[model samples]
Target: MSTSWRIRIMLTIHAKLVEAMLAQAHKDHPFEICGVIAGPEKSNLPLRLIPMRNAAQSETFFKFDPQEQLQVWREMEARGEEPIVIYHSHTHTPAYPSRTDVQYASQPQSHYVIVPTDPAYGEEIRSFRILDGMVTEERIRMINSYKAEWELSMEAMVA
Candidate 1:
């Protein structure tokens, strides 16, 4: 494990993004739903939600359609954006990265979010950083709007 993984970081995402993710998960219940949230490069802010089709289409696993993945990547590059957050749903299990997820985590910089759709688990969305097969849970700070959140932070800093 590296020192960077030990640092406690908060994932500040807009509430609408969260809702959209949850909705997608619910719509694809029993099967895993996966997607990525693209943001301005180096911003660490997730702004655009792009839900992807699960090529595997299995309840236990998810794999992005290769063509779709390439298209999305190209689109993000054209827009000067990066995949800041990669999200998926665990229909029957808790929101935690599995061994396969850790092994396949290609973007070490992106936040890996797991949304649980199991009725027994209640509403809990977990965020993590999967780097070199190490998974580190992160806190989420949901805000109504990015501008409002930024202004509040600026005010607090000035005070």
Candidate 2:
């Protein structure tokens, strides 16, 4: 039994969305922001990202808006995409999950990607899979420079 895990992610997005997210994150200096990533699921990959509309308030914490998320999920389904991961940024903290994070993380199968923007570690990103209060570090595989991948094969192996 180990604590390490990996999440395979595929990224293909409009450049504007990414820039907007980064800019927004940089602007909101001390609050954690969140968004969604959507894409098609290949043999072993899934598409996911944080949504901009929900990221405006990051200091308090984040909770997915069911209606908005459902819309994205439905949109993905219509476009043959799958919601594979959930991403959020930690304002001035590490990417590690907080106690609240553990309690609030309700998704059992989706990978959680955390972006830590501490001054000491700008743009530090990491992923984890939280289940039953167990948090494990998950490796991120970049499918390409513009596209990243996270494969949960390690978790599967452990399970």
Candidate 3:
């Protein structure tokens, strides 16, 4: 018998971002809302929030508009950024990844966040990592604000 242990992953993001996503989810209601959070390449920091149009406009599925997705990717490349977090909402289900979500996850590095808009689910939001058809739930650490390294350095100098 083989026993395998996996390390739990944690995603640290700004509380304001979470609030913004939740607000969007609520506004969308029955339909799903999808978006990406871009950050410095390999930084794993979700700094720039970009709410995208769901081409599918579905209650149980989400597909980003191809044109908008292309534009966003191009802009991220130009800014030396990458999609660090890919998020969407569930209208009537829990904030958990569905089989379709796992099948469609293309970015292995992105933190997949799901916000449940169903009243029964309350405000529980969840994050996960979907790679190679495996879903690993991650703990979210929400901070009031996220200061970049440069900002922190500048603050130290001012102090």
Candidate 4:
């Protein structure tokens, strides 16, 4: 049997989640906030916002508190979840990862999202897939439910 399969990666986010992240970014303006939106392990569905402390606490960069990071990762493991979206904000520049950002990307599967808190670019958000030092940007679909999208895809396949 010749089993050939195609790999499909769909990146999606809820509007409410975006709003929450933007709020956090604004609240921590000029200091750069970092967080994660985790879902079940290997699931692309992002369902929670975990606002992490920026250990660096500087406007130019962010580093998750090592202690907090360890604790959060353990909690996520306990919940059978993993980081789906690892997000941070750029206070003075556009919503794009910096050189250091790309170098420090540890999650090849997670969406590396950047949100600029400058207020100059309203509602601007970008995501990229960093695999082996290469960055590929992905489109974000603001959906109400991934289940609905899944059903729609299934219906199309059946038709």
* Highest TM-score model number: 1
Candidate 4 residue spans exceeding 4 A from truth:
1-10, 149-159
Q: Tell me the whole-model lDDT of each prediction, alpha carbons only.
A: 0.87, 0.61, 0.86, 0.83
lDDT of 4 by residue, 30-135 (tens): 8999999998765567888899999999999999999999999999999999999999999988887788899999988799999988877655888888888888
Q: lDDT tens digits, residues 1-159, model 3? A: 111111125677898999999999888878999999998775567889999999998999999999999999999999999998999999988888999999999999899999999878777889999999999999898888676533543444455
- Comparing 1 with 4 on lDDT, the higher-scoring candidate is 1
Candidate 2 per-residue C-alpha lDDT over 1-159 given as tens digits, one digit per residue, 9 for 90 to 100: 332322232222344544555666667656777766655553234434446454345575766666877787778778886655577778766778888889978766666777676767667567787899999876664433333323334345446
Measured over all alpha carbons after superposition, the RMSD of each candidate to the real structure, in angstroms, is 4.5, 6.1, 6.3, 4.2
Ranking by lDDT: 1, 3, 4, 2
Count residue pairs with overlapping backbones in model 1: 0
Q: Which model scores highest in lDDT?
A: 1
Per-residue C-alpha lDDT of model 1 across residues 91-120, encoded as one tens digit per residue: 877788999999899998899999999978
Residue 111's lDDT within candidate 2 is 66
Rank by TM-score, highest first. Answer: 1, 3, 4, 2
TM-score per model over all chains: 0.88, 0.66, 0.87, 0.86
Q: On a 0 to 1 TM-score scale, where does candidate 2 land against the true structure?
A: 0.66
* Local error of candidate 4 at residue 93 (angstroms): 1.2
Show where candidate 2 strays beyond 4 Å. 1-24, 42-50, 145-159
